[model samples]
Target: MPGQVTLELDPSLFGEREKRVAHSGKLVATAFRYKSGVAGLRVDNGAGTVTLLPFQGQQVWDAVFFGRSLTMKSMFDEPQPTRDYLRTYGALFLHCGGTSMGNPGPTDTHPLHGELPNLPHTDAQLVFGEDEAGAYLDLTGIARDAKAFHHDFVSRPRVRIREGATSLDMAVDVENRAGKPLPFLYLAHINFRPVDGAVLIDSVRDDRADATVRQPHLAQDEDEAVVAYHRAIAADPSSHRTLKAGVPIQPELVQTMKAAGAADGWTHALQRHPNGSGDFVSWRPDDLPYAVRWLTRGPDQDALGLVLPATAAPDGLAAATANRQIVWVAPGAAYRTSFRFGALDPAAANGLEATIKTIRGG
Candidate 1:
């Protein structure tokens, strides 16, 4: 059986000099606190390091492999202890949704991307164990979202890293406490920093004709250039696959795609850089039927969000309901999803490209 240790949130225990808490072979787990008083956990698996914010919805703040950072560049330098999404929006991997997800409609009142991101967790711990593959370390936390006499649910999010590995695995389970069927929506907002001249390989067709553009509701004061760009993508959805330097894909360009799974029922996506390095993600299409491609390039912020797996599009509650995309969980039942994100070396990147080609029946 795996052993668990409750994390002690004492400031002194996690000071700048006293961060390391546990060590086994080449794996090390450390707990620390940000200057803003938010608690965080960091794990180093010899090849890379990942910092997780256990207090703030267990979001991944940073991931570095072989001296290359995988996290996107944002205006904010550190995570803030606020509920405002924009203020604390910088994360490598952000979990979005609960009962409702996405931007609220004209009559909807839920916050943007639901109430999961930046929501504080009630408890957190470290779980360590060894399996057939090897030794592993896990950082787990409990988060709940409820209202007075309304929908109530709990979510347990975990991040795991194995010895001397460059990859990270994420899993979450959400259980409904309400006595009736509970509506649910979820999106894994895995953001990767843009690398110029990187080729995107995914389960979707390489051509633009196979994609569908989803226009988000823009404000009256939205930039005209952005609006025009959206129109361009809507006119030709296939033109949004490649990443070019200095070419602005401002605001955001979102496209809905029908993912093609491999023999094992999992879909793979990779952003292979010009230098033969890459970043990849893998998930089961059955667990998340919809794949959304999000891209935003600006002077202050740049993100290449490839293959954002979700139950439905982020078009708010009314639109999802109208489209019949809402997933319902029975009373006392749970909804679960898992995915993998990692950095790939030259050989690994080439191997993945070949595997992707095979999956595409090339």
Candidate 2:
């Protein structure tokens, strides 16, 4: 049997339980009050606590072990399109760059640096049974909204626990419930902040064969930034500079990366500090063909809080769909992408080889 746990949201425990989840315990689950009928789930894994608000399972907001530290600056739980929308749809964007309607991307980010459709919208159910079979949350309703009017949206999700494992699964479904067919965009904007003193660890999965980098808009200039970024990367083949600091990928480069892998797809990985106490961010693309790699640097940016976001489509939803960049679905379509947030124990450091073998289960 898995660990037995109970769920509820009691404000009195706010300081005691919620605060401790991020820095003390192995894990804890509690549902906090957000708005009408919408409950936010907070889980602590000692190193940090994660808050997941499942309004109809559309996941309006997600803040990890560090409390709402980052979201407080930009990712607030306001209405989608506007804070007031919360009264109408029970959904909100929580961030500056999310939408309420459309075929939200299957994952987040593309190599070409484009955007996906909207997040999932559907009628989902919450489960509170036992074990894997007892695990709750059925996103079937969201998966079945491909052909109908495509309007009303809801998200139902589940939190599963095992030793040293934390996983979040959710489904977004929208029912037209209106007269006309609904066309929208979806993207998972998963943002995480690295520990205060960590540096970016480059991996083989993020290699660029051509002299051309995938995106350039993120750069200070289109023509000059592209040339300099590529040149810096090329000159530093020995060191890790696949993406030069303080430069953004251009839009055209994003387009090129989209076309190259839209048919097949790719994977991106990052490693946290070798001796640190956190997990790396990983995402997989299911429906969208493209993946974008974004790096933010400046006096304004943090030395530790980096971003590795994934988008299903490139550009905005309108452009992705018009350019046939967005993947379409028949009636009753559903998509899912899974991520593992793993932490290394101090003992695992002493027995690095043994830990590796155990992770491999050999």
Among these predicted structures, which one has the highest lDDT? 1
- Where model 1 places Cα greater than 4 Å from the true spot, the runs are 2-12, 16-18, 206-210, 216-232
- TM-score each candidate: 0.92, 0.51
Which tens-of-lDDT digit does each residue in 144-252 have in candidate 1? Answer: 8888676889999888888877888899899999998888999998999989888888868644654667666677887776677677677766555567777766667
TM-score of 1: 0.92
Candidate 2's C-alpha runs over 4 A off are: 1-28, 31-40, 44-48, 56-186, 195-206, 210-268, 274-278, 285-289, 298-311, 342-362
lDDT of 2 by residue, 89-207 (tens): 22212211222222234452322211112233233232233455333321122322223433432232343333233333333333333354344344443334334333443222324
CA displacement after TM-score superposition, residue 246 of candidate 2 (Å): 10
